[model samples]
Target: MKPLLELRRVFFRYGKRSPYILSGVNLKIIRGKVYCIVGENGSGKTTLLHIMAGLLEPEKGEVLLDGKPLKEQLPRARRLIGILFQNPETMLFNPTVYDEIAYAPRQLFDEGETRKRVLESARLLGIEDLLERPTTSLSYGEKKVVALASIISYDPEIILLDEPLSNLHPERKRRVLNMIRSLAAKGKAVVITSPDLELLDNICDVTLTLSEGRLKEGG
Candidate 1:
């Protein structure tokens, strides 16, 4: 079978005036494995993740899924790829945690299925107790996991995480790591970007580093 996602000789920059953030980037994201991309701040890790998710197009080369260009397969791609951004809590606008987790499913699924997915996702992330609480009332860790629940509820095939362990407490960080491993165990393609490479050494199956606008294998 083809890889779940592939980035081939990709190139990107904000504008002609800006320096290239990614050049000749190539990667293959496979199912049932955890891939970690480590980079320092401003080294373009997030940019590459966005390109992989089809949120942004590369200036050159291609992002392909199942041997098809991602740009043409976006509608279907959205369901297959889910991205959890850094500081996800900052994007939470729902009144309650339940509403937040339910939002995406409600848009794509029937009411009964939406409810089931919301509850299931919350339970998976150990956030069931926070479902009825106001989103603003959640602690940072609770908010992070709840935001993660929102993505898991959608049941995407490929999950992209940006700085998942950043700013989280020790226990919350452990929870996030466990969740990543769990997702991979279920045959999902899990990709993560982090500045702290050592923290991820034990959990990732294939670890790569982004530096000087290129992605290199191994830390």
Candidate 2:
């Protein structure tokens, strides 16, 4: 099968004087697969993800979404890729949880479809009870769950989750992992970045390491 996303010889740096965070990085993310990118705190995993999500343009090389250049397919890329940044709750500004969850889908679907998607995603994330509550009133874990519900509401084909298991209780972490597996089962391409490398080894199909501005497969 064709890759859902591809990064070819990508290079990035914060600024002209700054050292490269990602240098000559290349990767292919396929549907129905779960990929884990393991790295230390300053390993540039987050930056790489931003490039994949089309939030950042690489200094060199290209990012392709389903065989087309991502830059050339911005609308399709936005519809196809869902990225949940670390502490994604920080990005949420809606008054209520339901509003937050329904926000993105509203851009692409009608009110009826958006409502259906929001409720379904909330149910899947076990946040149905929090729908009518104030988003600012939620606990950190609750906020995370709400944030995830929001991302999935649009049903993007490629999901990028950064530090998904961080600061969570073991049970919650397990639940998140299971949810990720379920997404892959439905043939979505899932890419995740985490410092906790060994925790996801059992479920990930491929593991790659990011270090000193480069990507290498395994461990």
Candidate 3:
């Protein structure tokens, strides 16, 4: 079977004047597997995720989603790929947690589906009660869970999580990790980028390390 996602010689630059963060990188991620991209800080980890999720365009190379070029989207790409940023702050702007998680679904899915997905995602993340709580008023960790719920609400075939375990307590960490593993079991491609080697080791079936735009052997 074809890989769910493939990045072939992808080169990404932030702006016309900015430097390239990812250079000549090729990666293949199969469905139903958790791929942990381990790397140090400033290692282009998040950049790669953004490119794959169609949030950012690569300067060169192709990002294929099930054999279709997704470098800049051609209508079904967004439904196939979802991305969660490294910082929860980037996602928490709505009036309440309900609206925050409801945002993506409202844009991508029908009204009935949006409501159903938001509630379902909140419950899955064990934050169903926070639906009415003000998003900014939530604790840092709570906001993180809300961010994850927002992404999961989209029901994308592939989810790229950047630093997902950050700020979460031990109990919630295990819960979230199990949830991620469950995604792969359900045939979703999950890619995680983090500096935590031990956490990745425990959670991922495959690990690859990126450093200075280059992937380490067996990373």
Worst lDDT run of 10 residues, candidate 3, spans 71-80
What lDDT is obtained when candidate 1 is compared to the true structure? 0.89
* Candidate 3 Cα lDDT to native: 0.86
Across 51-152, the per-residue lDDT of candidate 3 in tens digits comes to 888877888899888787885465557877778888888778899998998888898778999999999998898998899999878898998899999889
Best by TM-score: 2
Off by over 4 Å in 1: none
Residue 65, candidate 1: C-alpha displacement in angstroms = 1.5
Greater-TM-score candidate between 1 and 2: 2
Ranking of predictions according to TM-score: 2, 1, 3
lDDT (CA) per prediction: 0.89, 0.90, 0.86
Steric clash count of candidate 1: 0
- Ten-residue stretch with the least lDDT total in model 1: 166-175
Candidate 2 segments exceeding 4 Å error: none
TM-score, cand. 2: 0.96
Question: To one decimal, what is the Cα RMSD in angstroms of model 1 from the true structure?
Answer: 1.4
Comparing 1 and 3 on TM-score, the stronger one: 1
Against the hidden reference, what TM-scores do the models get? 0.94, 0.96, 0.92
